[model samples]
Target: MPNLQDVILYESKHQEKDFVQPHSHQTHQILYVLDGQGRCQLNEHTSPLKPDSMIVIPPHTEHSILAASKMTVLILEFSHLHVDADTREFLIKPVFKETKVWSLNLFVSSEIRQLLRKMLYEQSQESIEYKLGIKLLLSQLLFILMRTNQSMAQLDSNTLRSSWLKEYIDSNFYQITSIEEMAGKMGISSRYMNQMFTEVYDQTPMRYLTEVRLTRVKKMLTETDLDIVTICFEVGFESLSTFYRVFKKQVGVPPNRYRTTYVGMSDE
Candidate 1:
């Protein structure tokens, strides 16, 4: 959807006192810290950089990074055409129009780390379809960042209730009975909480909880030899029929088939 161009993606490690002089890029630049600490000087403002933190520099913005300790960072630079008008306005324009930096929560940090690593692998391989792979991955990365920004915006007037909701779901997805119940625990109306959560997460609370369960289902299917029905209830699915149906729809295969295929691949 992004149709990104002139892409440059790479990793950098800096020792203490290392500095990157003030510079500007014609393309939007994203710097994500993988380890250690630093400080980013953006125009007249400065922001701290620690592990799992990211800074998004809008096109032509003056910025520099100074490492206060050993640091590893992934840098991605790209420009895009208006091929997807909706993406430009909703995802790219709003999120990247200004220099912004934020620390990622554990769930988002893990996901973004995996995506960035895949992009690095694609860049290194330079395979025939690497360009396409990079474009898709970059688009996904941007979408995740956009949702994260939306969640942060929800708490700008108060506290990060959306983040709290996500963390709670991540930790207790298997035991979560209903969104209304969860909302009640948070001292909010189910309707209101669902609206706020969906606005920030781009999905309803139930959908997010389902996704978390499915992610666990996938891992257990590949890594363990548990029976499908057992795994289903373990992951908190109430009905075998529903589990099979939803697993097939979301994963494109039934649980047994997925396990079989993955096991065969691992053996090979």
Candidate 2:
């Protein structure tokens, strides 16, 4: 049950002659750069503002702006009251943090730019129901921004988890015996770990683990004089027959033959 209050719009053109001294306001500001380039100073940090760059400035945050060239900016300012608890905690709080500037590229699509333009037009009109139209547009825009942010966050988190899992396999391949054990260490189910591995690496977790073991076996075969059984055990293979089968299938040769071929090449 959020209420929007004091909705105002400002479309301004600025050049080298214009300057805004440091200031703050009580209402949240959504500023979009329509054209040209500029620089915004929010407290101690300065960010370059280009066409289609949108910024959300929180309440009572000191900020200033200077035009690097001729610039046109469309700013929407408003305050909200009685926002739902979850929305306030997640979407609103993050954007309104004093130390953070919520910025996104509005020029990612022509549709987005058109939507903002429509909102601006509605805001400028004094016709019947224009206020309602502006409010609806603003709500839609906020929804899009929140959804985009959530999607990007999820992608980043998945990427980080994938990287950590790969590093774990790389470092612990010698001791890892099964996919379940690896997944257990990470406190996730084997099936979910496999799914993550498949999505990120295009292979199942157990398959990737086997690949890691086989890669080490090949390295040992080429670089060291270790016997086939010793190399197999060192690479965490519990069964000689299974190791030989996998090695022949994946490397197209038995372990001894692979070592011999590598040795012959080095000698030649």
Candidate 3:
């Protein structure tokens, strides 16, 4: 009964059917895995899912889903309705490393999980207080998600060295590159690499890597039809599980559902 409209929730039991193909949407999507394992094949990237993971799929990215097991996913789709710097950057811009798209962590920590649960519980409430309460809670949760992802890059933050590091990440994230190798290649110590991105992008190179990956994965989600596993390797991710974790952390919605929203929105 849940598609990308209003406050929707997906409670499918063993969704083995192929409900759709790769597509894009008018509304942005958010998905949280309540339970079970799954795979998100976004454009050319495929990510394997785990319980408690969350994903954000930017609007207009074509993608599909191939569930690995039974799953309960909480899905939210909202129009291009909010205005803020965060909302603007989130609209598929180069400020990617500057937005939630650069998420480098996915553990929903107890704090965020609890907040999400509370909002979901209040979704159907019609009272003005309940509606405002949900909005405020959602904003807090978004802030937490973005902030946590930003903190994960504190290993070697450097603002002074951003020009060099940003160039490298923008050009070469598709290969098997490590933070150390990238730092060495940049002619600076790894510590400096971390510092530079924080300085330049307000995020570390490692954090930018996740953003780079998601940005490209988003390309695949919008333009291709590859399966989730194939999409994962194409994006230079070795394991499906790791890709899923990182993808969910950044995009905030399952790839398939995100893509489905695109198709659904276009039809409307």
Candidate 4:
């Protein structure tokens, strides 16, 4: 089930100067280029786009694209669960620089590329539950992109310590992991990790960790009916106090109240 919102997809040739109309969705939208090029003006930046690119736009921020070539694009619109105040803000916070482009790893193993091809081909076929195929394939596409983006970051880094630290976060992020543990595993001090992470990511290690945890927790809260306390523990917050504090500080509400807001939400 889609926790954040419904899913939609389109692959069509768009004309130059054709606009999608300046609009925002109630859920996040991801645009994956299948062919051609374009310019995406999101927030304030305007950058040239290319084929095999991906852009994730969070909810309710004005954005648009200008076709640079006859464009073939695959678009997915989905909602978030557990999108509590904290997660909500993070989602709304820019995931990427506005008006930037990210190149996909075309060198992804042949099997993975074949899978994507199958999805796209199967999608063009008709089925009573065609959406099922769309969802499954899109999920695969996203997982591959997420993993590739992370690996690229690791490779582009110059330090062995940096690579290890990032790998540890990627591996252990699902549970209640901490920067100190990240530092410990990297055989360095948390302070040292923080300095490097800040230089590399513009955010402290702990801050990035909190952002990841909070994003996952929000998904849980919105998607599952797990009790608040249980959800907190599941997402890796040991103390309800810390959860509540972070929730309020970043998300702008307490947990219980945040959950309640979604309970009656029309879309949820």
Candidate 5:
């Protein structure tokens, strides 16, 4: 039950040449660079700041940031979170090790970026039980960062490649035409890429891509007024027959009938 105390989270956008005077906080601070370029000085050492860079500054560590180009940073300040001894020993301690600043690869960075966005949204909405929500989200964020740090050493190059491939298909499945095109973009053979991807994710890239597209199609069918033909093409099916056949096979009902049944249930 790790609980954050006195949390303060905000984003600072700086214009070129802008700088923050040296300052220290009584609470631990996490600085995440979202956009642009800068340099962060912690004590006497400095590190370049670019998109996906992260810094964890312990309380009382004097630090400053200088923007070489326009920059956007998310700053999170909080007191030492009360946590179970086991969590503090393993996951928490390693994250704030001697290395105060580092960069995350694209896949891990994307996950962190999404969590940060959700935290920002929660902070903005301030709905009921928002503090609790933020605390849970913070825990999730820390767990992810810790696991990412651990996995960096254990993951092989092929594993990393597979992770990146999965992330790409997840984000761009609707626009992807073929596995060969994706393999070319990654500069790897389709056969090898497919083998590695399947090894890591337990499915071929095309199967994963279809799963992603159909997931979106289901959401649109139930929540939106878009017709089946439009939904099919919108989700990259290329034609209604193919979309309908796959949708019915996977979902066990035609798209229209599924939507009619589910949406009607929701109204009751």
Candidate 6:
């Protein structure tokens, strides 16, 4: 169960010259743009406002909003301090750490907007249960945000995994030799490996490997006194002729000429 504190709703219209000066609040706020456009400045970061822009401002964080035009915004302010520790931590930390704006248009459903409207309606009521209704709706909204955060965390994990895969490839590129061998070492099919690489890097796995090899080769050619033939085999090219062909094709110069040109530049 969660406890709600200082639960309040505000729907305000701002003219072009009207603005809220930078300030801090004791309770968390969900500021949803209902109409018009503006810019919200939260601490050092600023986000553009439009319809469906929801900004989550953490407790005690300085923020302000200025309208670009006649703008309307709905703000829901509450605290989750009395909630279970995990829920409280989840609600407070990540929302402020990441991008503050959660554009409602990106979600698959419009349930959040509906819930906010329902809460607004409940706030207008004179009945005793209206308070309970507002709390319930607010809780639902927090859970939705939590779920969205979890999904984003999973995406971050996938991105980290992709990064690890690229690093592994970079470290072992000289010995791995082929896409199939690279895939075998990772325990995935080459096709799937290529798919993952392409998704993250926008290039096939083999192309990325080639780029890595080419970069190393370019560095060696520029910095080392090694002969082209030795440099070619050392950088893991099996055929000297194939190396020369690729070097020319990708770099617009053969390896020997590239090395000579680098030396000439260094002498200047």
In order, the Cα lDDT scores of the candidates are 0.85, 0.76, 0.63, 0.67, 0.83, 0.78
Per-model TM against the reference? 0.58, 0.76, 0.48, 0.46, 0.54, 0.60
Off by over 4 Å in 4: 1-5, 81-100, 109-116, 121-129, 159-268
Q: Highest TM-score among the candidates is held by which one?
A: 2
User: On residues 1-268, what C-alpha lDDT tens digit does candidate 6 reach at each position?
Assistant: 1235547787889998688999987777888887898899987799899988888887788889999999888888877653446656665556555548777545623878788889889988958998778777877778787778777676566567668778986887777677788778778798877777777789987887778889989888888788888888877888998888998999998888888778656446
Query: Best candidate per lDDT, number?
Result: 1
Q: What ranges in model 6 sit over 4 Å off?
A: 1-4, 81-99, 160-268
Better of 1 and 5 by TM-score: 1
| Residue 118, candidate 2: alpha-carbon lDDT | 87
lDDT of 5 by residue, 76-144 (tens): 776656444665677567776654676898988898889888888888887887777777777788798
Ranking by lDDT: 1, 5, 6, 2, 4, 3
Q: Kindly indicate the candidate among 1 and 2 with the higher lDDT.
A: 1
3 against 4, candidate with superior lDDT: 4
**Model 3: per-residue lDDT, tens digit, 32-95?**
7777777776767877767766667667676666677777777655543443456445432322
Looking at model 1, how many pairs of residues clash? Answer: 0
Candidate 1 least-lDDT 10 residues: 1-10
The TM-score measured for candidate 6 stands at: 0.60
Residue 41 local lDDT, model 6: 90
- Between candidates 3 and 5, name the one with more favorable TM-score: 5
What's model 1's TM-score? Answer: 0.58
Clashing pairs in 2: none
Estimate the TM-score for candidate 4: 0.46
